[model samples]
Target: MNKPPRKKNPTFGIAVFIVVAVLLVIATLFYNAIKEKREFDSQNPDTQSISSDAASTAAAKPASGAAQ
Candidate 1:
């Protein structure tokens, strides 16, 4: 009696490799974004206060440059 040969799925391996690469890229981007945001926030601890002060100053000033 003769035996039949088994078939292999080559696409499965390629698909798995693609998925893993995509996941790694996404994770790297997420990590970098979080790190940058943390660094920015730390450097500007009083962001809210500075923004509020700027808003108040702008509001107090005249919108036009004409003399009173």
Candidate 2:
């Protein structure tokens, strides 16, 4: 009986492996990002300070055209 032909090159298998690895990396990064966001929202004081500082700066700024 005749045997079926075997794949001559390994490039296809390597390409598929690389693609899957990249996708897994991307998914991990996105998951970490979401987790960090949730943690930040739960209450770190640094975030509060930043927001307060921004509000203070906004309040201190002069209104447009008032100096003219």
- Which candidate has the highest TM-score of all? 1
* lDDT: worst 10-residue window of model 1: 44-53
lDDT of 1 at 66: 65
Where is model 1 more than 4 Å wrong at Cα? Answer: 1-5, 49-68
Residue-wise C-alpha lDDT for candidate 2, range 1-68, written one tens digit per residue: 99999867799889999999999999999999999988888866456566888989989998797885
Our tally of clashes for model 2 stands at 0
Global CA lDDT of candidate 1, please?
Answer: 0.92
- What's the lDDT for residue 21 in model 2? 100
How far off is model 1, as Cα RMSD? 6.1
TM-score of each: 0.61, 0.55
